[model samples]
Target: MRITTLAKNYFFYCVLILTLFGQNGFVYSQCPTVTNTAQSFCDTQSPTIASLQAVDNGGGIKWYATATSNTQLTNSTVLINGEDYFVDDNTGNCGPRQSVTVTIYSAPTGANFQGVCVTSLSQATPSNPQFVINGNNLQWYTTPNGGTALSPTAILTDNTIYYISQTNPDTGCQTSRLSVFVNVGLVPTPLGSAVQEFCNIPGSPPTVGDLVASGNNNWYLTSAFGIPLDLSTPLVNGQFYYATTVDPPCESSIRLEVLVNLYEPNDAGSNGNRSICVNEIATTIPFDLFNLLGGTPDNTGVWSGPILTTNGFQGTLDVSTMTLLGSPYVFTYTVSSALCANDTSTVTITILGLPTATVSVSPTPSCSGSPATFTFTGTPNATVTYNINGGANQTITLNGTGTATLTGTYTANTTVNIVSVAS
Candidate 1:
C-alpha cells in the first residue's frame, strides 16, 4: 500500500513538471501580444520587422519574416506590404508567436509641366504652369526627400525638377515624393515706343495701323489677357492699347503698353467785313474776334490780326485807337500749330467820317416869340437835326442842292444849334 501511493504521487509530480516547463524542458512565458495585428505605414517611413513587436516585459523579442520560420530577422530588416511577420519572446519556448500584416503606402503620381517667364518692369516670374497629382492633400517640395513644404504662391525655377507628395485623409499616411520637370520657354523681345501721337483729321481719322511699331504685332484693347484687335480699329484720343509679339507657339507674357493720342488740327475761321461811323466808335464795345469766325474753330489757336489783345483763348479788338476815318483796314487772323499747317482769315473794318454842314439864319432881327428860319447845307439828300433854346430836336432833309431849312417858334433870347450833320 505505501509503494503504490508513492508511485501515484511521482506520476502526478511528473505531469505537473511537464505542464510548468515545455516539452523540451525549457521554461515557458506568454508570447508577445501584438497590440496592432494589422499595421499600415507610408513607404517614406521605412518600417522594419522590429516595428511589429508591441510588449517587451524585459523578456526581449525576436522577429521573423514568415510565421513558420526558425531563422530570426534583425531589427534593421525592412518590412514588406501585404506580408505577415511573426514576433515572439526571446525565451524560445513559446508554443505560438503573434503574427502581424504590414501595409506600405506608395507615392502619389504626378505629371510634368511647362511654364513661361513673365516679365514686368525689372522683375520676372513664372506663369501658366500647374502641378497635377492623383491623391489628396498634395504638397510641393524642393528636395526629393524630407523638406519644408512649398507655399502655393512660391515662384518656381525655370527648367528645374520639383518634388510633389500626397497624403491619405483617413489614415494620415503620406506617400513618397514624385518628380515633375518644368520646362520654361524663353521670353520674346518687345516692339516699339510706348506712347504715340497722331493728327485727327476730319475726313480721315487715326487708325490702329497708323501706330508706329515693328514686329509681328498683336494689339489688344486691354492691358491683360484679351482678344487681339484688328488693324482697322479706330484709335481713341488719350486711350491705351497693349502690344505683344507672337513667336510661334510661345508668345511674350509681358505686353508693351502703347498709349494713343489723337490731336485735333488748329482752325482759323472765315473772313468777316463790317462798317461803323466814326462818331459811334466811342460807343462800340470791345468784342471777341472769335465771334467773327464763320466755322467752329479751336480755342487754343493764337490770333495775329492788327493790334489785338488776347485773354486766354479769346481775342479782343481795340477800336479806340484809329487815326484814319473813312478808310478800310484789313486785319489778318492766323492760327499756327507745330503739327498742322497755319490757317489765316481776314477782317475788313471800315470807318465813316462826319459830314460837313454850314448854317444860316433867315429873316434876321425877328421879333420875340416869332417863327424863325434856319438854313443848313450838307451832303446831297442828307438829313440834319437842330435844337432851339435847348428844346426837343427837329429834323430837316436836304434836296439835290445839298441845302435845307428848319422853321421853329422861338422865345426871348432864343439860341439855335445843329446837333448832328450826317449822311
Candidate 2:
C-alpha cells in the first residue's frame, strides 16, 4: 500500500510541471498584442524594418516577409508599400505572429503653366491667378530642389525660369519640382496728343478708329484693366477714352487719356412770311433783316433775295420805293462756319393796296327836318368812315358785297363826303 501511494504522487508532480511549462520547458504568455496592426507612411520617409519594431509594445520583435516563413528580416530591410509583413515577440517565449500592412503614399504632382506679361506679374494677386499650378500647398522655388520657398509678396524677375512643387497634407509628403519657364513680355508705349476733336454729324457719328493715334492703338472705355473697345464704338462729345499700344498679348500698363470734343456751328433760324400795308410803309423805320427771320438765328448771317436797298447781308427793305403793290418778295439769310456747311432761311413779305369807295345820297332834294340816307360801295368787306356836311364823323362796316348805309336828319342842301375806306 505505501509503494502504490508514492507512485501516484510522483505522477501528479510530473503532470503539474508539464502544465506549468509547456513541452519547451519555458513559461509562455499570450501572443504579442498588436497595438497598431496597420501602418502608413510617405514615400519620402522611406520606412524600414526597424521602424515596425519601434511600435511594438512588447520588446524583442522579429519581422518576416510572410506570415508562415521562418526566415527573419533584418532591421535595415526597407519596407515596401501595400506589402504584408509579419511580426512576433520573443520576450519571455515565442508567440503567434501577427500580420502587418504598410501603406506608402506618393507625393503630389505639379500642373501646367503659361507665360504672362511683366506688368501682370508685378500686380499679381490671389484673385488674379497669373501663375497657376495643380496641387495642394503650392510653393514657388528658385531652384529645382532644396531651396527656400518664394514669398507671396516676392518681386519676380522677368525672363526667369521658376520651379514649383506641392505638399500632401495627409502624409506630409512634398512632390518633385516642376520646371516653369516664365516668358515675360514688355508693354508697348503710346504716342500722340491726348485731346482729339471731331465735327458733329447728323446720322453718322465719329468712332474710335477716327481718333488719331501713333502706333497700333487699342481703345478702352476705362483707363485700367478692361477689354479693348471695338473700332465701331461711337465716340461721345466731352467724354474721355483711353488708348494703349499692344505688343501681341501684352499692352501698355500706363494708358493715354483722350478727351473727345465734338463741335457744331450755329445755324440760321427758320423762315418767316409777313404782310404790310402800303400806307404804313412810308412811315416805317428801317429794321434789321434778322428780326424778320424766325427761330434763333445767328446775327452774323448774310442776306440775299429781293428788295435789299443797302447793306445787303444785314440790310432792311424800303417798302416805300417798291412800285409793285400786292407782290410777294422773298429774302434769304445764310450762315457760315469754319467746319460746318452753310445754313440758309428765307422771309417773304407782301404789300396790300388801299381800299376805295363811292357814296350816293337818297332823297337828295329833301326838305329840312327830313331823314336822309347815304349808301357806300367799295371793295368786298371794306370799312368806311363818312361825315354829313363836315359834322361828327360816323363809322360803318360794309357787307360782303362792299355796301354800307348811314341814316341821319340833316339840313336841306347839306353835303356828305366819305372820309376814309379799308378792306
lDDT of 2 by residue, 85-157 (tens): 9876654236557777887655444344455554444553222266666666767788877889887667666
List model 1 lDDT by residue over 317-395, tens digit each. 8788764553677766677776666777767778877776777776775577777777888877777888777879987
Quick one: RMSD of model 2? Answer: 15.1
lDDT of 1 at 30: 45
List candidate 2 stretches off by more than 4 Å: 1-42, 50-60, 64-78, 82-84, 89-105, 114-139, 155-160, 165-175, 178-423
Count: clashes, candidate 2: 1
Q: List the residue pairs that clash in candidate 1.
A: none
Candidates' TM-scores?
0.41, 0.41
Predict model 1's lDDT versus the native: 0.72
